[model samples]
Target chain A: MMVRMAATRDGYGDALLELGGNQRVVVLEADLGKSTKSLHFRKQFPQRTISCGIGEQNMFLVGAGLAASGYIPFASTFAIFTERGFEQMRNGIARPNLAVHVCGSHGGTHTGTDGSSAQSIEDLAIYRTLPNVTVLHPCDDVSTKILTKQLVHLNSPSYTRTARNKSPVLYDGREDEIEIGKGVIHRDGNDAAIIACGILVSEALQAAQELSLEGIEVTVIDMHTIKPLDEALVLDVAKKCGKIVTAEDHSIIGGLGGAVSEYLIENYPVPMKRIGVADRFGESGESEEMLNLLGLSAPFIAEAVRKLLNS
Target chain B: MSSIAELEEVARKCRVRIVDMVYNAQAGHPGGSLSEIDILVALYGTTLRVDPKNPSWEDRDRFILSKGHASPGMYAILAEHGFIQEHDLTSYRVLGGKCQGHVDAKWCPGVDFSAGSLGMGLSFGMGSALAARLDGSQRQAYVMLGDGEIQEGSVWEAAMAAVHHELGNLNVILDCNGIQNDDFCDEQMRMFDIPKKWEAFGWNVKIIDGHNMSEILEGLEFLKNSNQKPNILIARTVKGKGVSYMENNPSFHGAAPNDEQYALAMKELGVA
Candidate 1:
């Protein structure tokens, strides 16, 4: 099947432009609007868009302030830069349970050539620790758009990680399959489940396809929502497959893999191998190079699956 | 709408509650609360347009206490204005208490911003002001900051953004109490030319005695009359204004008054 390619950041921007129709929906940017794809909304709805200007800490609280005053505010910056405002996110946004949607684009080591400083290896881990904050890392442009729009009805704070790099458009015509807290399974099998998120979702699908050719059937789950994790689905797969290989372009400490493992260990234990960055920073390179170097590409995911099954 | 004398009397009672709340709770910040009581009393008692019954009413003026450890003052004033019962003050710093050790909007009524970490309320206030403008509401945001709280770089980020956005409806009251938890502001960080610093940030600066009810009212007037830019009233204050032994004492910045000290405070405030 032929696949289209699109960046998740574009989907974030598309969602903002569509949400602009609601008078209560407002956009905030801290001088990285173009990078985070909020410039699209800023240009069209300059009046409702607030330009916070080179201040991420101020941007989060400003978003919170807007949330408190009956406005749905969406703020964005690079993933690594968003960490600069994590305390603000914790105290102002999450503590108050304000409905501020924060999009941290260019997340993970898959963001090309920006080097270690720009690549956010633990954005997911930090945000997951926050109480009353939903954490999301949608796989494709369509899913990003769908999940972001769902935030309008949530009436709570959320942190979404989007990528600057383009990936295979998985949910192009299957928009209805996408939900905020539920995982989307691309290919299903009983051998083992490959639970992944962000850019690794596509890699997990590719690995599952490759494994199928070799008679090792596998389940491919796009575990997009990291917090308020889909424990029901995770437990179902752990029961069916008996073995699991979790993958992501984030740190293994507390990203997608950490969330899944923590849930399974507590509820139902299973033999699992988390395929992710080994708590190391990325160097200046193409996303493909970084993914391969960090053991997060399709082949690496397949190898991990085989290793898990063998174990 | 209260006269200056009526506001002063109300503030004196709040001062009694500020120390009493700390003493009953066995732990709370009384020093900064005593210094900020007069301003909180004047703002909520007379000028701020808020309904205690409808605390979440849209278009109500948003008040953010950035220096939230000084929450005793806010809780006392909130009780005086009926946001909560006077009995709720007993829950200060206690678990399951609406009066959290810090100012939190989720726990308490009429609190617009949940502030505990310093240098945050101004930015939140700016957001509130912007939201009001977008909704075409005439409500303003009042943020109270401490002298030491401005030491955080994020505060400067908000100060710059408020000026850049020309947020005329954003008002700030800095409790220039000179002392922080560890020591005085001069010892911790010399913020020389404090008013000049705000003026440099393009804000309309006003200085007043934060303890004086009439001066605090005048400062509120200055905030109301000023427009087209952010405003800040750099109110000079003592860390522990009402209690003699605690006055200008850094140790009292975050400490609860002992039983003896509490009695002394009540006697000094003429509530004995």
Candidate 2:
């Protein structure tokens, strides 16, 4: 079957445009509005969109102020650049539990050619550590649209990381199954499980199909929300599968792999393997080349599953 | 609106509350709080359109204390205005108290935004003003910033944004107390001619004596009528206005007054 591919940033832009109809929804962007796709909302609602002009720190604090004054603000920028405003987000947004949607596009190696400076490998980890913050990494366009729509009603601070490259559509138009902090099990197997998020979710599904060809069945779970993680589902999978392989487009130390490992070690303690960038930065390359080089592709995940089974 | 004499009486009471809270808490910034109490009293009692019963009233003017370490002054003013119970002043900085070390909106009633780290309130005020414009509300936003807080790069970013957006409803009052937590601001970072900087940022600038209730009220009136551009009042003030010993004293910046100093401060303020 041919799969339709779309970038998560496009979905974010489309959702923002739809959210613009609400008078309470205000959008703020750094100078990267065109690149981050927030310009779509800006063009539609010029009066409501604020162009902060290369000032991410001021953008977040302004977003916080808007939120305090009963406006739902979506602050957007490149994922790596959002780090420049982390303190503002922590103090101005999270500390108040203000309803601000912080969207960081071009996350991880999927951003390509921009190199490590532009890509955010540890963005998830940084936001996850903040209190009262909901960290989300959507795998496809469908999930991104659903999550962005839900964020409007969520009266808390949230961080959504989207990708620059097109990823395969993993879900139908079912917003019900895309609840935050709940893992979606794509395929179930008794032998092993592959838990992944972001662009790596599609890779995990592909790896599961390849492993099935060799009579090694594995479950694929889309762990979209990193914070407020679905600990129950992860524990259930650990008990049933007895072996696990985690993959992501971020650094293995603090992304999806780190979150799952930390949970399992304390509760389940099964054989596991983490397939992601290992203590190294990304370089300028095509998205596909970077994913392949960083061992975030299907073949690499399959290799990890094979190695885990043999071990 | 209250008369200048009435406003001065309210400011005197706020100053007494400021010193008492800091002394009881045993850990709070007193010098800057003392310096800023008159301005806070002027706004809460005269300028700002706030209802103690409805703290989150839509269309009400919003105030953000950017120099949040001086939260004792804000808390005292809020209590005086009946936004919070006067007895809560004794619980300042204590556990299970609404008055925290820094101004927290969640814990304290009538606080439009939480602020502790410097250089954030102006941006937040600008945002609130923008939100009001989006909603077609005529609500104004008042931000109190410390002179030392201007050294932060983020404050400049916010200043630029406010001008770019042409936020006429946003008013920033720079409490130029001259002293910071460590020492005098000029001794640390020489900010020569502060009023010119605001003018350079496209703001309608006014310099006034911050401690004088009539000057503060006039500045507020000027900002209310100046709807063509964003307005900033650079109010020159002594670090510790009422207490002679703590005046311009960096040691009292973050320190609660000792017994002898506390008695002397109360006597000087005529609150003894």
Candidate 3:
């Protein structure tokens, strides 16, 4: 199931409206209303949405209180600031097992221009390390909407990362078949697997198209949920394909590549190439230029896959 | 409303619970918890309009412990209010115990939010106050912040947000015993004018003896009648209030009392 074009934040903004319509749902934002697109909820449901001016840590704790008081809360902020509030998320929400949805926008290099400080290049890793936290980075608008709704309903603490820039939608909004821990194989093949998440999914699909002309079939999977990681599917693909390539907009060290490699190294050894920010902070540039400069574009992923297959 | 004698009695029992629970487990923050007991007892026994039987009561006043390591005092109050069985508190910090080192909102019945890391309780209180305004519920949120915990920058961020939002329904009681994790708060981080800082942050500030039941009750009454501004009652207290040896001892910050120490403290409170 695939759509044409959409921004993941758009899906989040849309889903927030739907969630806000429910009397039990409450939305909290930390001054970055426009960045996370939570402004839509603020405009539609002024009463239920609160913008706690530039105080991300306060937003996290406040969300906990609101959730405890019997309201489902979605606390939104930029990835960097949200990372600064990790202690609060760990103690107040996760340790307490409160049903607060901690969502972040401007994830990875897709945030553009603001450079390393603003890009949440390590958001996935930070959240995945925490106990009882579900981390998701949806591929497109459709996937983002599904993940947002799922997180809002999950009894445990959850986090959803949203990209700032627009990207091609890989899944149609009508796919009611979305499961939390299952990865969707966008392209099936025997040569290698290109595991991608968030905005990188669209790039992986594009790379596969280019690679296919050279008589290579690359399997691509949108590993949206990072924790409770689709270990079974990953191992199955690793066993079959023998060569795996992971592409994401986050740090190559702890994002999709690390998660997949950890599973493979422990279970089944395999050759893998990781295409992401190679241990460097993002530079100020347009989103497209940043992807190319950081070697996260479709061409870069395709190139990495070529190298992996040859090795 | 609880009388001065009743509040004192409740405070004495709170200290006993804190000491006994800690002594039993050989793990607890007896110092900070002891300093905070009188105020917590005052809130639960006399000031706060909350039902222990219905912990989630919408209109109930909220009490958040920002200095979460001192959870024994809170657990003791909750037990007294019938939120938990008094005997269940013996399980403090034990394996698979609901009574964790910190208050967990999910596992514990009376806990409004999970807290441990300092400087976060006030933010939760601010949010609750905001929620009450949004939902048209008439409720007040009270928070207890350790003097040492106020060093976190997030505390000021929350203070700014709370006053900016004009949450008159919010009241903060800073347990200004002047002690922190390892040393005196003044030595660790000098916050001499706690009231002035809150006042500058646009809160209605009041400084009072935290152990004095009359002052504690008066502060709560004032917060209840305030129109549209947040309030902070700086309760000056000794680190270990009732016990002679533990009083003003920063070493008791997270130390559990031994059998001998516990016996002496309980004797002082007349709990035995």
Candidate 4:
């Protein structure tokens, strides 16, 4: 696809403006005007954008009401507020199939410097557990933009997890196939398929490049869409490689690892090593420092894959 | 013909179904359901201009149970009015039953909005009222809320919006049974002078004995005639009403009446 380097929040802002170009779309935010990247749309469509001023639960319920009234609503807030509305999202929005898009900024450790609580590692799990909710955590800004637009068109309740800090652009319009529930293989190999999502896709690619030099042919797949996981591709890769490695910037339980493991166990089980944050809280530190401290770098993923392949 | 006497009989029958339905299923929120039975009887039987057979007939009045735990009262009235089979009442809370633990639109007929969670009903009600007005429909929207569930901040936001828009078609009925699941509404959270507070929020307020069918019916009629202001009827009622032992008791808030308790309550309600 024609991917471009834009800030994920900015992509969100642009996609919202594009969404608002349609008269049926309405925008809502909870006081984080600039952070959520909704300020641009708010300024352009003041009548359509309604700010709830940090009241997350009310924003959710009101969005649900508006949705029931036949308006496409994009309700944005920080991950904490988005997580706080788990019940409202489940009952008022998702359960009834209310066409409300829940845009949660700062989804994973990419939020950086903030502690584990703000990282919202459990958000994917929380949203995935709800029936009829489609969960999407894009790899970069461009994917975020495309997915946001696609979700608005889908007319279903969706969660788009975005990052706070900028990272190197991975897809510079070099790809063609980006479909929901379909993994994009950045590299080809028979040794193992290092499936990853969010910012961890970049890490898995770097690891694949390094492992290739050591005579270790590694395949990398970006499993961006978490729910409705690409089970077919995952099982195919698992069968081809005899081993697999999954990584994400989220918790091990209900994040990428859990999704991959649950898929494999049901269809094609293989030796797997999970490269992500363990069951622990995050701490405030520099972005690079936290990444290194948490052992989420390419070296760690490569090491885990190497160990799994050998074992 | 005294409207009060007629409504009293309806309320009595509502309580009978509530006790019987809950006891047969061995599960359901009997306390608040019984407490709100009179309000439902008064609204559906005497006040609200609704054709049960034609529930989604755009011009029919809308009623939402914001405190969804008390949906038994709603189901009893809906079934009695022939919206659904009255024989389906005994399957309350059972798997594959038309009546689940809470109001489910997919499972039951005439259930406008599915609600299992508390505090979301008012905002939905407000939205429906707004949509109706925007579409030039004359039907009014009524939402029944629990006293404790009013503590949810969304309810106030919805209240403020309803007032700001002057949704004359919206009527919020607060089931002031005083008891929540854990404690009495006043003890758990003080909602002193609820009608005055709603008035302060720019709503037309009416305080009445919730159990008194006459007051409920009168309040409903008065609300329908209003032009530019939404109505909030503050109905003070016993938490576990009708049953002698469960009356005013917090324990029955979500408890299903046992066989003996059901028999006694039904006998008192003149069921047998």
Candidate 5:
């Protein structure tokens, strides 16, 4: 076991560069190309890149227009700033079922020192509510690259959330194994299962490893696609493990934890603990400090699993 | 090409159809529809290079009704141009019907984009124009925006982007009908000196009488001949132009005329 760390934004930039070879693939940005890493695509194909000049709503509508005219447009902005264009994305892109890829970078508290204004703790929830929108939060660089490429072939609108901080790469470039609406079972254990997305997948894996030493075998699953969730896997895990612990780098209200809990409560009726940000906003801090302060670190997740087991 | 008189006759028929659909549906924006019908007739009859038999023709010029609340006008034009059957106009706003309350490209043929939310049509038009430019296609993109819809911040965003991209194939027709949903635009948001505002945004601006067939054709010709910059034709129009009682009346902005008013409107348009 060798470990490699890379920001999910890097994966997005690299994947965009590769996708830029296709003339139909255009990239639109809202004046945050450098931070969102869409500048890589701009550098490669300047003609194909559209700078929307700090207008997220216009960027969304423009992307919809391009999609309507037989072009696949990837519209990128800060995850928090995507709220400015939510209505445009809903009405223009999702409502029409256009093939536009909305990439929201710096998702969640992992955005670190940029503070609450930059962090998007509710982007997935907002996008999930829109009909015909595929909401995805890739776990690490590898998954992000895989999913970003997959978005090119998808004919419906999709939202992909990437993190600003570098997380441990969980895959070895075996992208063929990843599917959009399917969950990847990283570690299988019988005691309890931990389902997480975005940067929390690595945290959940670390928690599973730490809990394994104490004779508590916990299964860790990467539930990346929030909308069109992998129900069969979740139900199988719930029926097998009996207890479920969900973790994410977002709010506990309507993120991965909320989606998982809502599904299990209805279908399986299992006892579960959701580990995420409670109703409070995040502040500027180092990435590791923010994760620890927000109780999203591996220890916090393991503690949550232990509590669920004991109860 | 249709003569000015012939175009006016078509516009008159479309105006009749607009009032009829709105009145039958029991809910619709007839004022803007009536104001914009003549402009649509001018475009559909002469300017646009579209095949009604092949609504999705790849090389066809794209028309987006950005002021989407005026769907009755667009639907009438689509029906007249043979893109959609005339009987479909009777099902305006009916559940699971082709004629939706707003212009839905999915349900309506010859509609280039879906628009109801204001200020988005310009952006979509710019995008289509940019796409055509990239593909080296001769087709152009035309977007019809409401006078009040320009107040939306997103419209300016698209305007600026269109100029920045230097989208020469993009044409925006602003139906400056004076009134919005509640009151006169000047009384509501005070969108004064709109032509100068567009000129300042780096677009080639043209002011035209929207209801006059000759002025409408001249503006279209100017746009078609011009190159290097995006063009915007600010067509000054009377709200509910053909219908005498609803003319310049803000009350008819989103209200379908009652039976008495509908009959009077039909008589005024000579379709009674």
Candidate 6:
């Protein structure tokens, strides 16, 4: 398998430049164009891009207005800064059911040295609670770009979180594999399924490969859309594997783990373990170091899977 | 409704409806509603280029009540402009009612914004203005804000952005009614030299007595003629302008007028 590495933010920028072809697609930036990779689109379409300065709250509503006016507006900022305009997104956009695509770049503890403040471990959780709001956390650049382009056809609002660090391009040439709400099976097995999202998808792949070498064949799923959880896929994996391990770079509570558990408990209860940041804040550190410290690396995922299998 | 007398009569009728809706519902902010009715009446009657038959007309000027709690004023004027019937005013705050407690575009007619929160409409208006500019249309986006509502930090963010974007198509109506939900604007928070603040932000500011129909028309004319920068009409008004007892009274800001007081308010506005 040819492995190419790229940041999901770069994919977001690339997708924006592509979406610029559509006359109605406009980009909004809250002074994070460079960081969120929206600068690429801004450079090409300055008239269509709205520079909102350092006002995330204002940027969100501006996007809502554009959406209301029949224009598809995409706004981007840091993951944590997006939270600053959460209410605006909820009231002005989601309640009105405006199709404003908001991309919160540099999500999760994997965002590294910008520290706990910049690393938004709760964006997915908070956004998932909003009605008519779609939440996404794609694993790699290819997947991110594919999901973002699909937002143009959607008449509802969405919150897509991207990362600052690069991950293995799992869908390098498999552009047909990614969809907004469906999970993609990276590695297939029936022993115990490892469902992960965002940066943790690569880690889950590594974990599955390690377990396969030991003849303990494992399943790896990239559950990108957290809000609209692919219930059929989850139920399928749950029924086949009979055991599940949910992984994410977000908090263990109200994230991918929380979402899966909530659904499985009422519909299909199975033995499960959620691998994530134990309800705690992150600190400034290297990407690999942060994952290792938070016990979110491949070794930790493999360890959890092993423990679940033994139990 | 082009003449001042005709517009004043419209304002008076809307005033009756404003009080009637809040009084009948036994809920809502009647003070700000009464304060803002004159401006709303003027805009819908003489200033705004809108087609009541096509409320969602693509080229129509956008009207956003950023201080959305004062929906009665908006609803009343909307009724006067034939956007909604006076019969629809009966649904104020009712279940499955089009007239939501807060103004909502999705639920109601002639409402461009589905608003409940404060300091949000300006940005939305700015967006609408930008969209108008992008489309090369001559349509304008109008937002109404309360004196107390300016305290929200996000409003400043948008105020700066609107000026920076040079949104000449965006117009703001500041209903300086001097009162908030809790108390007067001075008591709650002193928004010192409000005109200077807007002027400092590089906006085109015009001052007027909000309840004066002729002055409001002049202000509207000024906003319409402005180019190269956004404009704000600072309309100094009395909270509960039509109701004698509720006038300048903090208690009436969020409270409903009693039946007796409602009758008095109706009588004060010369409503049969």
lDDT digits (tens) for residues B217-256 of candidate 3: 8876777766688888888999978888988987788887
Docking class of 5: high
Stretches of candidate 1 exceeding 4 Å from the true structure? none
Residue range B31-72, candidate 5, lDDT tens digits:
999999999999989889999999888878989999999999
* Regions of candidate 4 where Cα sits further than 4 Å from its true position: A1-4, A114-117, A153-156, A171-176, B1-8, B45-61, B126-140, B152-170, B186-190, B199-202, B221-230, B243-245, B256-264, B270-272
Candidate 6's residue-wise lDDT over A40-139, tens digit each?
Answer: 9999999999999999999999998888888999999999999999999899999999999999999999999989999899999999999999999999
Predicted complex 4: DockQ: 0.47
- Candidate 2 lDDT tens digits, A146-167: 8899898789999999999898
- TM-score computed on alpha carbons, candidate 3: 0.94
The candidate that achieves the highest DockQ relative to the unseen native structure: 1
Candidate 3: tens digits of C-alpha lDDT, residues A1-311: 55477788889998898787688788888888887888989998987887788888888988887876778899898878899899998877887787889888889988899877898788898888889899899888888887898776688889889988889876765477577888998889999999999888889999999999999998999999888899999989998899999989999988788999998998998999998888888878899999899999999999998998887
Q: Residues B9-95, candidate 6, lDDT per residue (tens digit)?
A: 888888889888998999999999999999998888887888989998999999999999999999998888788898999999999
Query: Which sections of candidate 6 miss by over 4 Å?
Result: none
In model 4, what lDDT does residue A66 have?
65
**For model 2 chain A, the run of ten residues with the poorest summed lDDT:** A172-181
- List residue ranges in candidate 3 displaced over 4 A: A1-4, B56-59
lDDT per residue, candidate 4, A23-118, as tens digits?
667788788868989888899998777666666776777677667666788889877669887888889888888888988897776677777677
Rank candidates by DockQ, best first: 1, 6, 2, 5, 3, 4
In model 3 chain B, the worst 10-residue window by lDDT is B219-228
Clashes of each: 0, 0, 0, 3, 0, 0
Between 1 and 3, whose DockQ is larger?
Answer: 1
Candidate with the larger DockQ of 5 and 6: 6
Clashing pairs in 2: none
lDDT of 4 by residue, B1-272 (tens): 23778778777877888888888877778889988888888787766777766766666677888888887888888887788887899768888988989998778877777888888888788767765665577878889998999898878878887776678989988888889889887788898878888989988888889887767777777787666889888888898788889988988888887778877887899976
lDDT of 1 by residue, A225-251 (tens): 998899999999999999999999999
